[model samples]
Target: MGRMKSSNRKKIIGALGDPRIKPYLEASGGNEKDALALYRWSVELTASIQETLGVTEVLLRNSIDVQLRKWNNEQLGHSASWLLESPASPLRSMTKSKRKEALRRAEKSATCRSASHFRHGQAVTHDDVLAHTMFGMWKDILPNHSPGADPEKTENKNRMTLWEDAVKNAFPCAEDPEGEKTYWRVAHLHELRNRVSHMDSLLNVDVLDVTRDAFALVGSIDPVLANWLTGTSTVSAVYGKRPE
Candidate 1:
């Protein structure tokens, strides 16, 4: 809680490496103390953003999962989870690999935890794999838009069909007929999540804008949840504490 000593700051800067501290040091106009303070502030800000993103990720995943499950069952009958579908149907080549990887990791985790539902000799459940999936998996699974992309391509057509059949329902409050807006918003948050996960610099990032985007995305699915998330978020408070 006390101001860090100059010697202690020096040690921290050295440990953090010159490259890592360079942007902060520059922003502080060569003042090592101010730079170090900014670095600490950034760490706190990152933590706050991570916390908010955690909630958003879970909400996004669950909302999409519910729709996907319903759509999968409608298409393939009872007890059919889209996540368990083979390469021939939805999920296709693009996502099948990622799904397999996530499921493999989930199974290993369940085995390690000796999960109650994960019988030693039995296969892992959909919930287990879903819980283990990364944020990017959800983002990438959504339809994409490119100016030059051919609408007739198998992948593009499949993405559109999936959106029409299932993904669009994930956002009950949003109006994204073609899924473009949703994809762009999710993509922005996905990049921010990656930066935070990698412990990269946020000194130049418009973190407030990122927060707004996050809330907006959440609001699209459920305004009540968005209100709750925004009301409880610490991003604004952390942002206010930034070193001048």
Candidate 2:
């Protein structure tokens, strides 16, 4: 067998960090070349996962955004500020403190870009509102009303207002039943999204499961979107190439 290069082995160790890459190296019987190969494979797999995840996030966010806008308009008219602050709106069901926090976040997100455009003497469009607002903020405003239930229910008479209504309209399916399951899945994906955005290592994660979950979430929203993502995805191909 060819000897492993010291410089290449050192580079792999440094790039992936000790705790993560150490076990693989030990399992390879100190075969630096084999360990380095594993490291490279992991990097490639992570990249593929990140790429697929980005597409899934965009689709999920857009689906939710469209539904929210439709529901809000139907329920309380189309005033953006009223949607965020009206006593009859979803934000009303939240505790006073949570409502305040949510409003602050919504206002901050809504204005940040428009403020920039105003300063630059540029026209800001309605698209800017959609672009600047984040998926996490939407998740935050729609808290789980029935925290304890069989499959977890989004319908609660006590909390019947805009939040529950919006969830019903947004998810509205047998796959997620009450929408709690969908909410939970999106929450999990959001956490994973954060890690990927921050450039954190996903070596310890089950990349296949993450990929499956992402596709499933998109599938739940729109099967056609999921199919499109699957056709373009490199996750499965990259995962197949992992070192044995």
TM-score of 2: 0.68
Which candidate number maximizes lDDT?
A: 1
Model 2 bad stretches (over 4 Å): 1-4, 23-30, 74-76, 81-88, 92-126, 141-163, 198-201
**Tens-digit per-residue lDDT, 1-244, candidate 1:** 8988889889988999998899999999999999988988999999999999999999999999898787767766675766655533666565787888878898787677654544665677888788888888877767777468787888878888888888899998998899988888888899999999987899989989988988999999999999999999999999998878
lDDT for each residue of candidate 2 in 57-140, tens digit (9 for 90 to 100): 677657666665666566665545323444444444543454355456645654555545644433333444445455565555
The lDDT values for all models are: 0.85, 0.62
Instruction: Show the colliding residue pairs in model 1.
Output: none
lDDT of 1 at 27: 96
Superposed model 1: Cα runs more than 4 Å off: 1-5, 85-88, 114-123, 146-150
